[model samples]
Target: MAARNWKKGSFTGLHGLESALGLFYTRHMFRLAHFSDIHLGPLPAISYRELASKRITGYINWQRNRRLNLDHGIIDRITDDMLAAAPHHIALTGDLVNLALREEIERARLWLESLGPGEKVSVVPGNHDAYVPGALARCRRAWADYMTGDDGRAPTGRTAFPYLRVRDRVALIGVSSARATAPFMASGHFSKAQAKRLGALLDRTAAGGLFRVVMIHHPPVRGATHAAKRLYGIGRFQKIIRKHGAELILHGHTHKPTVHRIEGQNGMSVPVVGVAAAGQALGSAKPPAHYNLFEIEGEPGAWQIRFSRRGITDPHGEIGEVSGALLSPGK
Candidate 1:
């Protein structure tokens, strides 16, 4: 009996050591599929009653302007191609619906279900997701599962902002910048409370040696979008980053593909990336509908992000590789 117990203890110790070595010596690789600004169309028929508020302007704009610019079929094609690539996890930045109507919010929930389970996909909201006063509240309840962290803990009061989800070696931090704006405005904001919490989250996580990826709807940098749609408290975000730093930042709202770098701790250049509208047509003034596939390799602080930009070409309607690049953030 004594010999058997000794053998069991030895085996357990060896197993723990083996797991530690596996994490240190070998690079854990995974593909992250990112796409945003769906802006799903064929809006549910609005009632003359429903069109009384700010929704009226949005409805008219959708019917006259957006209908020609965006296409649901294009989104289908883009998603088909994205699924074929077989990503480990998917990150959907926001704007699933344009008007944030009850019908649209429910439809967006269905659309999220079609993408994959809530566990496999992480979503954040866009300005369009919270287009009206109560629309944001409606959206949060519907997408609560997708928006919350995987920590399995219930919130004390309001659902907290800047939640964290860990997958393997990656830590995906979700930030909410979506806010209801007045007519003709598309701005986004992050409150001081969220900013303070975010700094603590980043500092503690970065110290623990996990690759931190920030998922927010609005870009956290100046000149990234028009003044009307710009993300406020960008300075606050940058300050936090300069002190603690994140490995990557992903956002969507501009319906444009953009790549940028912001200051990071120890003088590293953190990559801030954005994708074009996932449901936008091929040649609608905006970039073609597309998705970003990031192939992450190596360990935290020494990681390499290889990105493949897949997109559709206008007039031809052919899906092809739009661009590819090797990203060494903080290098």
Candidate 2:
């Protein structure tokens, strides 16, 4: 099976391919599993010097609040289920650490490795990953490949925002909204430069008939989060999508499952979805840890995407489907 030769007057991945010398042809179906805000815990020991800056606040927050809500036991169960289901690809939106500490970032990388190789997994930093001024540099050094665009075309080894990855009939656009904020603040932002570049890339990618999915850390819709932790440029982000158009948007940060509708082209509505923290323990304050499994099957124009939201409800519980929705309406 030469796998459909792309060299012939050939075809785009948009079409079904015949393999084994044309004995059979199968339409391609892409399955993507999405989860975010892992906040892998058991934070490293802190020092007085380390707490000299913004980290002191984060350190205290983790010790008092986050550590109790985040449970690795729950996370382990969810990860086991994800691996068992084995989607074709996985996207992690961020918060893979507690304090953006070097040890935390490196540990998160190792956890990502256990999930799969860089090709199978994608990551975008969360606010916690950028909790301090220079922490992003360390994250860039550690998780460069996961953040790289398809074909290694993204800007250097640094974690460049809004890189593009084209797979099958889908274009996964990775964007960074993670930013270091003052103590008691958890927010995200997208620069004007990044917005311009993203608009161009969205137009180009959508022209190729790929289902554009915007990967971001914070929800782009207005009123999606508390004022202190919201995405700074919600209006700008909405304008870009309304102008350029994306079929779907995925984000993390709220740790609550949500499906917000936004305007798309020609009166159609685009779906912006947010998943609860993948490692959070079951509690009254927030939704339980869950990951979304999207079943994407169809050709370029007649695509169908179905969502299955799965979660781990308790420490001794097994993962199960919590709900389902048609990501693409009218079909």
Candidate 3:
């Protein structure tokens, strides 16, 4: 990820403050656990037909490098830690599978079920999820329950992107950037049509005085990823944020922990955060497996957020908080 050029608010150890404030806001606090980029492995057997196109390159890459670096056991540990924290809701950004194989999709669905029910969790797809022309349709069919909005309809057909799910005082908005690309290319696309819908959703949610959180698989800011894996139409996405604003934005794709700020309404700078891959092993070249817990409280226009980054930081394979910060809204 590139260095952030805009001003960023400082992060503090707000856990102490949270302890003090808990007396009054315990019931109001919404704990949201976010993790992404599973790329679940032990890739199932593939027929010659399965490896006909993009799968061939992905298969070769996984067998050569990904299988060794990504450990399902580490993912299990992370999930255990996340569950122990007892977040009110869990948000998974994307890349739940590698090759988007039929078996991989099915296995990922089971993994999702283990986390919790559809009402307690939300998801968005990544480039790998839609690795081929038909892979995304398969994922939609298998994981529709997880991606459906609060209205109880699965995200299917044309009105898919920018689905809405309201939980308590927060409005969780999911947008898809997942799409199939040429071999050796790992890119995502956010259409203008999605942006138009997102703008409307943001407006409606904002009017309801709910804490709006936008979830996407790829980072929406510029220079966040390599050209080969960038999110096209990011400008349109940013335009939506600039106009209607959101309380926070969560994403995963660069496979690294990053914080960037996007200009929001009335000069408010919304926090755009990305977590390291949940399946990445400790001591790997990239940041180790990790998850983020966000503590949000307070009503509209007076929100307080505390962010804690937890992950395996040692050789013992134990997961702990790597960093903490007090995030001020509109900073």
Candidate 4:
């Protein structure tokens, strides 16, 4: 039960979360789990063939890629373990598919469905989820019974962006940064309207004392190494965070386990955390398929984030804690 040694104010490039932490106000406490890049099974060989036939598939060279590491049993086990920890809620960033295949999307839905019911799980779509014209909508349709009941009804027809999942003490702000890239670009961009809407949503939610946890597919900031500088419009995303405060930011595009502090305009540091791929066989020091468990406590407006690493088995295994963040404290 010992906590992992965490620096008081540190930022992980989980997503380019740059919130300026001004005065040190009282800290709120909350716990939740974060995982990303599921890349569910029954992958399309055609997509691989298509990638192979072509020189490249956006930023990734799939021709050289060897495998799709989404193990169903492993994922299920991890979910079971995380649930045993009894987190407040779960946040899935994106990349829930190897390709936007119908079967894959259906399988993904089943997988998420097997998890806790509506009040327990929140998810967003990644580029692969929305690669096709209406791929995202299809996935949403399949999971509608299991996921939140947004009903895909927005003022606009685009259900791809600005989805909400509200639990007991947390509100998951699911944003769609998934966009089909043209050959060499693997980056994503949220349209001006989407960004504006997201900012406004955060503002409203924050004012209402909701713990807003923003989830997206791409990294909001640059990678630890400059090798992946293809960061698109991350600066704008950071500005949105500054405009509105968030408790924790979670993402999984880069697949590297990193933690960072986003500085809010108010000079308060916001904690952004990332998890390595929960997909099977990622070839990392830790298990190829691992998920993060957060121990959250506190009332609405005030919550804390404590990070824990969980493997496929050993649900209650104490891997250790990383860092914690305070959102809004209930008066």
TM-scores of the models, in the order given: 0.90, 0.89, 0.91, 0.73
Superpose all Cα atoms of candidate 2 onto the true structure and report the RMSD in Å to 1 decimal. 5.5
Q: Estimate, for each residue in 1-331, the C-alpha lDDT of model 1 and write its tens digit.
A: 0011122223457766765555323346778899999998788877888788788888889988898898788888898898888888899988999899898999989988988887788888899998988888788888877887877542222446788888777788888899889888889998888888889889888888888899999999899988989999999889888888899999999888899999988999999999999988865788888899998877766888999889885577777789999987875
**Regions of model 2 farther than 4 Å from truth:** 1-26, 154-159, 313-315, 329-331
Error of 1 at 318 (Å): 2.2
- Tens-digit lDDT string for candidate 2 (1-331): 0123243224434333433234334556678899999988898877788889889888878778888888788888888898888688899998889888888899988998999998788888899998998887678668887888885854333336688888777788899888789988999998787899899989999789888889999999889889999998888888888798888889999998999988866566788899999877776489888999987776545678989999874456678998997778331
lDDT of each structure?
A: 0.84, 0.82, 0.90, 0.63
**Models ranked on TM-score:** 3, 1, 2, 4
Report how far residue 87 has shifted in candidate 2, in Å: 0.9
Q: What TM-score does candidate 4 get on C-alpha atoms?
A: 0.73
Query: How do the residues 1-331 of candidate 4 rate in per-residue lDDT, one tens digit apiece?
Result: 1223433246445322432333222334445788887766555445555445222453153323424334456666666677777666778888887656677777787778677676567777676676655676787677654345354444124644677666645677877777665544456776677778788778877777776778877767655324332446677888887777677777777666777767653665666777777755534343456677766555443455555666543344323333334333122
Q: Which candidate, 1 or 4, would have the higher lDDT against the true structure?
A: 1
Candidate 3 regions with alpha-carbon error over 4 angstroms: 1-27
Clashes of 3: 0
Model 3: how far residue 267 lies from native, Å: 0.6
Candidate 4, which segments miss by more than 4 Å at Cα? 1-31, 42-72, 145-156, 224-231, 282-287, 299-302, 312-331
Winner on lDDT between 2 and 4 is: 2
lDDT of 3: 0.90
Candidate 3 residue lDDT tens string, 221-327 = 99999999999998988988999999999999999999999999888899999999998986668999999999988788889999999999788888999999987
